[model samples]
Target: MRTDVLHAMRLARIDLTLVGRNTTVLFNVLLLPLLMAWVYTEAVGAEKIDGVAGRVFVLAGLPGLLLVFAVFINLVNSFTARREELVLKRLRAGQPSGPAILGGAALGALVLYLAQVALLAVWMRRSEGVTVANVPMLVTVAVLGVALFCLLAAAFSGLTPNAELAQVTVLPVLLVVLVGAPIAFPAGTLPGPLGDVAALLPATPVVEIARTAFLGGDHLSGGGAALSTGGQWMAALPSFAILLGWLVVAGLLARWLFRWEPRHG
Candidate 1:
C-alpha cells in the first residue's frame, strides 16, 4: 500500500522480467535440474549405494537443491547485484522502506520457486509415481525456507563486497546443502559424527520435510522423526520452529547490518 513498496514492487517486476528473459537464468533454473537429475541417476545406477533406487535418489535430492539454489543463492546474488548497481542506494533515497525493497526482491525468487515446484511436481508424478504425503508440511517448508533464506541472503550481502563475490560466498552454503544434506542419496547412509553434524544443518530439516512428503513420512528420523512423531503435522513443528528462529535471527541481522550502498561509499 505504501509508495515505497509500490516502487520496490515495480522495480522487482522489471528485475524478474529481465532474469526471466536471460538465457543463463533459464539454464540454471531449467537445464541444471535436468542435468543434475541425469547425472545423479547415472551415478546411482552404476553403483548401488545402500540399496537406494536411482529414481528415488534423484527425487529425494533435486527438490531441496532447487530450493537452496532458488532461495539462498539466487536471492543473495540479486541483492548484491542491486547494491553494486546502485539500485539499493537510489531506492533508499526514495519513499520505500527497507522491508518493501527486500520483500519485492524476494517476490521474484518466490515466483521462480513456484515455477520450479510445479515443474518438479509434474515430472515426479509422471516419471517416479511419487506422491506428496504431507502436502501442507511441504508447502510450509518451501515458503518458510524461501523467506528465511532471502533474509539470510540479504544479511550475507552486508559482508559481500561486490556482486561477483556474492556468488562465491553463497557457494559454500550451497555445497553444504548439496553435499552435506541427507537429501543427497547416500548421505542418508553416512555414519558417525559427520552425519550427525549434517543432520543439524539448516538445510537438513527442510530437506527432511520435503523427503517426508515425497517418501510418505518413512524417511523422517532423528530430529525430524522426533519432531514429527505425533503425526506428519506435529513432526513439522520442530522444523518450523528452527526455520522461524533462523528467519528472526537472520532478518534482524540483515536489517541491522545491511549496507544500502557500496562499502567504499
Candidate 2:
C-alpha cells in the first residue's frame, strides 16, 4: 500500500512539473478565469444580484468556470494526449494500482484548483471585502467540486478520440455546467421547470455550495440572509447530494469506458 502511494506521488510530481512547463496549460488554468472574472466584474460594475455585490456573485460562480475550463477540459486533453502516446498503457502495466494511477494523473489539476481558490479569496477579500461565512463548508464543497470534475474528465477522456478532439467533445458538458448552472445565469432565477432541471445539473449544487459558504444562502435563494454555519451547511446538503450523485455516475462511466491505449492505434 505504501509503495502504491509512493508511486502515485511520484507520478503526480512528474505531471505537475510538465503542467508547469506548458505555457498553454498555465494560461488556461491561471489566466483565462482571471480574465473572465475581470470582464464580468467590469460589465456588471456595482450592480447587485440577489442583494450581493456583482463582484461577489462573480466570485461565487468562478469555481464552476474553473471546473469546466481549467480542470475538466484540460484533464480531458491531457488524458487523451497521454493515451495516444501510450503513457497510460505503460502505467497500467506498472506497479501503481488503477485508482492510484488515475488519482496521480489528476493531482496536478486538484492542486491548481486549490491554488486558484486561495488566490482568488485573497483578491476578493482585498478588493471586495468578501469574508467567508463558513470556511470549512467552503473547503469541503470545493474539494468535492474538484473530485466531481476530475471524474467527469476521466469519463469524457474515454470518448475523446485524440487531444485535438477534446475541444469538440467537451462542449456539451461546458454548456451544461457553465450555461445551465448559476455561473452564467443568476441563482434561483431560472423559471419553472427550467429551474428544476438546472438544479439537477452537476454544477448547480456546487455553485449553491459556494454561495452557502461565501454569501450565506443556497442557490435557490439568493444570498443576503444570516444563517448559522451549521444552517448554511444544512442548506447545501441537497446540492451536495446532487453533486455526489453525478460524481458516482461519472466514476462508473470512467471505470467502464476509459481506454489505456489510443483507439485507432
Candidate 3:
C-alpha cells in the first residue's frame, strides 16, 4: 500500500517537473484563466448576478474556466497523448499498481487545477477586492469539482480512438461548460427548464458553489442563506448531489473503460 503511494507521489513529482519544462503548456496554464477573467468581464458589460458586481461575477467564473480548459480538455489530450505514445503501457509493466499509475497521472492536472484556482483567487482579491466567504466549502467544491472533471477527462481520453482526436472528442464538454452551462451569464437569465438542465451539468455546480462562496463582498456569509439567482448555500445541496453522482458515474466509467495497454493491442 505504502509502496503504491510512494510510487504515485514520485510519478506526480516527475509530471510536475515535466510541466515546468514544457513552456507552451505552462504558459497556457498560467495565462488562460487570467485572460478569460478579462474577456468575461468585458462580455458581461456591467451586469450583476444576485446583486454581486460584474467583476466579482467574472471572478466566480474562474473555476469553471480553469476546469474546462486547464483541467478537463488539457487532461483529455494529456492521457490520450500518453496512451498514443504507449507511455501508460510502459508504466504498467513497471512496479506501480494500475490505480496508482492513473492517480499519479491525474495528480499533475489536479495540482495545475488547484494552482489556477489559487492564482485567480489572489488575482481577483487584489484587483477586485474579492474574498472567500467559506474557505472550507470553497476548497471542498474546488477539489471535488477538479477530481470529477479529471476522472471524466480520463474516461474521455481512454475512450478516444487516438490522441489526434482529442480536440474533436473533447468538444462536448467544452460546449457543455462554455456554451451550455452558465459561465458568462447568470443562471437565472436562462429559461426555467433550461436552467434546471444546466444545473445538472458538471460546470454549473462548480460555478454555483464558487459563486456561493464569493457571494459576499468582504466576508462570506456564515449562515446558509439565499445567495444567488440560481440557488443559495442550502439550495446548492442538489448541485452537490449532482456533482457527486456524476463523479461516481464517471469514475466507474473510467475504471471500466480505462486500458493500460495500447488500444490497438
Best by TM-score: 2
Candidate 1 has an lDDT of: 0.71
Ranking by TM-score: 2, 3, 1
- After TM-score superposition, the amount by which residue 184's alpha carbon in candidate 3 deviates from its true location, in angstroms, is 2.1
Better of 1 and 2 by lDDT: 2
Using lDDT as the measure, name the better of candidate 2 and candidate 3: 2
TM-scores, all models, native as reference: 0.85, 0.94, 0.89
Worst 10 residues of 1 by lDDT: 221-230
For model 1 the local lDDT of residue 26 reads 73
Candidate 2 residue pairs in backbone clash: none
Number of clashing pairs per prediction, in order: 3, 0, 1
Q: After best superposition, candidate 1 residue 203: deviation in angstroms? A: 1.3
Cα lDDT tens digits for candidate 3, 209-256: 776766533112223244443335566677688889989998998888
Per-model RMSD to reference: 3.3, 1.6, 3.7
| lDDT tens per residue, model 2, 1-265 | 8887888788888988988899998998788878987887787777877777777887876777777776898889989999999988898898888888888866767788878878888888899888777788878877888888888888899999998898999999987775688864565688898888988888877777776687766544554577777778777777788888988998899888888889974
Error of 1 at 139 (Å): 1.6
Q: Order the candidate numbers by lDDT, best to worst.
A: 2, 3, 1
